[model samples]
Target: MQHDQPRPRRANKSGIRQVLFNSLSFLLIFLPIVLSGFLICRRYGNVQWVFIWLFICSAVFYGAWEPRYIFLLISSILFNYFVAIQLARSKSKPLLAFGIVVNLGSLAYFKYLNFILQTWSSVLGADFQPVAITLPLGISFITFIQIAFLVDVFRNSSDDLGFPKYALFVAYFPHLIAGPIIHHKEVMSQFTNARLAAISANDVVGGIALILCGLFKKVIIADTMASYSTPAFHLAGQLQPISFFDAWGALLAFTFQIYFDFSGYSDIAIGLSRLFGVRLPVNFDSPYKATSIIDFWRRWHITLSRFLRDYLYVPLGGNRHGVLRRYSNLMIVMLLGGLWHGASWMFVIWGGLHGTYLIINHAFHFLKRKIGEQSLSVLIASRLFSLLVFPAVMLSWVFFRSESWQGAKTMLRGMLGYNGILLPERYQAVLGSLNDWVMSTLHMHTGDLVTFGSFRAVLWMILVTAFVFLLPNSQQLLSEFDRSSGLAEDGHLRSRMLAFRPTAISAVVAAGVGIVVLAAIYAGVPSEFIYFQF
Candidate 1:
């Protein structure tokens, strides 16, 4: 698209944007009232009252996006609950299959219908217009949650789980949109704890701390990085030549942009849930620190990986089958996983690339085992090879971020040096006496190579890398506050110095962070979380 080209209008009344966690509508209005109601209900009334109030507020929170779609969400919950009831009554395979089919069918209709229609029209030269389907907010997450519940009920016959609690499970605002994909078992059990109805001082302080950290990540880091990443990808999408440094800058910038954005949203969600004495599952660990694609999946969007493993992979015979079958299964699962992110071929390619990387990773491991070598060189080789993990994952992200094939190709070409190199002008000063020789011999271009807001974009990548690689994450800092919830009980602790205790110092720090994040939010328009569309 040329700069002056008029934009094409979207289909009529496509969908209403949901309120963002960082948005004023959510922060100033929705959160305080809901938090108060939960505390009030829990204090004076029974646990059931607490659950009921949370569910009602959750419904309002979701319905506020598009009032008409609330029925669709409720209908999904009611329908799934009915199926679970039937499955509990009789352990019928056909009934379970029907329930799964229905859930998937609804998802396909709402999420994939437009993609399919558009593809078919392009292929078959059809003139038919696509249907104006409004994808209800969090439909993907909601559908998967219900499907998982139905499966569990079929397997274990959970007839007495009750409707209100189940409704709370589905409608809960925190994990409802872009989830850590909480299991019904984990959430329901927590809510039932007689002790959970009353709020703990640690939970309150720590939850606020986590929300503050999340706001900082979103408002300060991720949204700021978006200034560079968005335009870079847009330029590539337009098929403009991206210089080498420019492309890699865009790639690394987006990798962290998405990392912080989604993780921030997860932190906020977990914190919000924690406020009500519930803990949503951990969605992100330090995934960029992963040594391989396998480790990456383990750390990133973990609950989704668990879902695929339990519901999809295990059923597909998992590793019980021979190697070839296992590899095929792995590809199928990832391909579907990519498609699950969004109804696009770019996503499919992203999934496929990860699947390939996983296959190669497994192959390398298998070959190493066959060697049976305890030599120092083998150990060093293994460790050095681990370095490829970051670059490999970063490469995959280019495809994930770019919507069109040409755009992704353009970025990839630059990353691989098909595009000419552009050194930062400051680099010329560092080169000193060797500068003239290098300029002539190496053909390096030097100028203003990066731009992000008012600063050079590449400079921020340094801070982003250090923060992801060196600093303790928000959850880790708040580890002492709630040890039993989520991974705090078992996950790695890289540092103790950053522990967020409920001391005066910690209180001051949290307050300072909260003030900074609020100011940032007040200063700019908060961007929607990257994963919300998925």
Candidate 2:
């Protein structure tokens, strides 16, 4: 219906013209990486750059496809902007209710229907497979943001939004793919009166640094860990008598790999937004260092946690209700949160486990408060004990990450000390060599080389794990550095000078070159961002 509206027409152009212009724009911005990749491929005959280019092209295509989808994106922008405008102008309860229902309803349909259908079909054995609905790119994030905007409008928390500002908010390309999901209250005011030419050097430099850090985490750490983790998990069922060390090693590798991978993407997204003069929220803060599950959630995916609190937890009676109701709301929020990640039963189980952990944590806190046993020592001990409970939470990630229910069961069995008694004969040589290597490495016994790979993989995993837990959080580093000198005043000359210094410039240049080189090296591979599946 929105598409049918008569719109001002733009002159048509040849497809080639469109492609060339878009391609050139992308290449210019990404040129440093592109050129480096080309040089590397030419000298070494490695094809990494080819894959990177291909991936870039694929992303471009995804954005460019059915150009009508761009209109759909624009329509969403207009709808929200108009709703905010109307709500600001009038205090009509009906108008406010309509805005809430429409915005949230659209989000639910597009983002959750497939998940709901698949889940229901599994449980009910009903022949109710819905028509294939290809989710538009970034719909989940964009819709949630708009819903937030509408709520803010109704609450009179903000005034009516203008069109261009709202358009940019929804369609900002950097946070478009995955997100540190923006809120209208946070972004709209900045955009409406923005001086388009007022580019801050500090913002640009910081953005570049964040993007490079994210790229390094993804390409070097996450992908490398994934290479081995994938196979170990895939063959988990056949891995009878799974050496205890090997299973743990594989699990640890994956745990670190995913953390780096997702956090890296968030960093890049935030950095990219900064480049456009927007400050996105920090999404991670060395979550692995958290001494308890509650602390870990607080540190990890901070924005999502805030969203759950404001939109779901508070509305569902949060702590205002009695302890029992509060517990129920926590469980409901987490279960839905798990379902939000994917349509799979594993995610549901994962959510349930987290919910259970949170509920128990609340109970502990309640008891501590009731007894008035608020000693500093007791608080510290509680936190330390929570650290111990963290592993149990991490272990559940096995189910969350596994490919199938059987795979999860096999991994769990191995974890519980199940030695495979009926392994295939063909696996004996591989198993024997790996077992020997594991034994020799630990000074136990020589068994199998196949196990050697797992050992080596685990060694790498430990190194990475140490880094994750040991590294200072970005916020902490910034705070300490600021205290030594003074805070970088917003848009200040000193900040800009520091950003454009030779050392900083050189570092960015080097990063750009490196990205190009890596892109070239993997040019033949068509790797997509892992989160795209969700």
Candidate 3:
């Protein structure tokens, strides 16, 4: 017996033409963004120009290649769009089932096939070399968003999708690169009624602010740390008696680097969206200050977590089944999530580690609740334990960050006090050259371990971290700086003792402008967003 399939809907000629127009418009819009970079490059002759070119090229290439994968992209979009329409029309269980299968199946193909093949090859000891598959840029995130839309559609929880709005939702340039992973229900309504006009001053200011912030994080903070971390890790096998200090320095630098790099991207995404008068949800909320692993997950890469919970975890029974089943579901979701990051065993292991940690955390909570003696001290102690646990996670990042399995293994072994035995003459020349390069790079004196520059970088990072943690939330700031009073209240004791002043606003604005100018001058070429790997 043959199964009846949902008939493919006839092409909407206007919709197809509009898609083409939208695609072309994106290319045209990017031209000015690129021209600005070219101008900067010509004027400064700096590495910053190289980054701008890289970003511009990546964006343009992806949009151009969308046609090559247009069948898949459009098919996925149509599948969800139609399903949502049908669900909104009536609660149809079959429509929902079909939508879920298609969404999940497409995601698995693009995201997991390589990882699956590799795992099977390793386990079976077979000489299986897979062909290199070109992934659509941002497919990882876009796919997740699509899946969530489908699930919501199935549940009759979403509105009907409009073709133009849906296309823009997926292809919107700012969040398109490294996403806050928007949902259809969240953004589609705005696009439908979008004001098509020249950019406003507020948008211009906000977009510039976001762009500068992203540049500062990627170029000044992340890239500088990468220079030190990359070389140190590369020479891990050669270091003798363990350069523990250097290792710690490199690792810590990388830790902060990834944070700023990712959080900065999210900030830029949100800020840019604001320019369009659409508010994208905040993705990072000082995640480092999170007191528990669960809290950290909620704050860090929050959109991804929301996607997993809504699309993957909940569908697989979540915690609704029994405890054992819930634990199993958590493990499965995390393992898949890890593999989603990359087609590497290291990512799988990373996911599994997080899954295990979460499971244990859940179990502990269960036990504590049963005993009914959970105290503030115990909570504080648990938070401390979680902080200590971060080093292990950081070490796992070596694997995540490495280019190859062998490189990661070598680094790991080096960290564990393993160095291949060799005659003094064998590695002497190589070691000497590496040492000279490092010494010169840092301008190190005879006894000074760190140069003044490195010290200053560290100090700057500390200050940034302090600001991130101590600064009031946006809501709080807005409340304090209420303009109706003709004087903004400063939330400091000294300021309270004195009084508010109109000059305070001008001073703040002047300081902000000065910082932006300084940051732009110091900013290097644009660094690639870290999530681009997935």
* Candidate 3 Cα lDDT to native: 0.57
Candidate 2 lDDT over 73-108, as tens digits, reads 767777777877887888777876787687767756
Evaluated with TM-score, which candidate comes out highest? 1
lDDT of 3 by residue, 329-436 (tens): 999998988777766666777788788878887887786687554677667756666775567557767756555555556566545535422222322344575866
Name the runs in model 2 displaced over 4 angstroms: 1-68, 92-94, 126-130, 192-198, 236-243, 372-384, 419-456, 475-528
lDDT of each: 0.79, 0.60, 0.57
What is the clash tally of candidate 3?
Answer: 2
> What CA RMSD would candidate 3 show?
11.6
Locate the minimum summed-lDDT window of 10 residues in model 3.
Answer: 1-10
lDDT score for candidate 2 against the true structure = 0.60
For model 2 the TM-score comes to 0.75
lDDT of 1 by residue, 1-534 (tens): 111111111112213223568766678888999988877877788778877998898898788768888888889889988888888889999999999999999999988887777777777877657678766777888888888899888779343578998998999988877887877887787776476645688787767888888888987899877777777787898898888878988888888888999889888988887787777788888888888789999999999999998999989998898999889989999999988988778888889999998888887788778875576776777787689999888899887888688888899898877888877657777789999899878778765564432344556778788999998777677666667645553244555766667889977888898888777767654364677645
Error of 2 at 297 (Å): 1.8
Off by over 4 Å in 1: 1-18, 125-128, 157-159, 424-427, 446-456, 488-494
Q: Candidates' TM-scores? A: 0.92, 0.75, 0.70
Instruction: Note the clash tally of each candidate.
Output: 0, 34, 2
| Shift of residue 162 alpha carbon in model 2, Å | 0.5
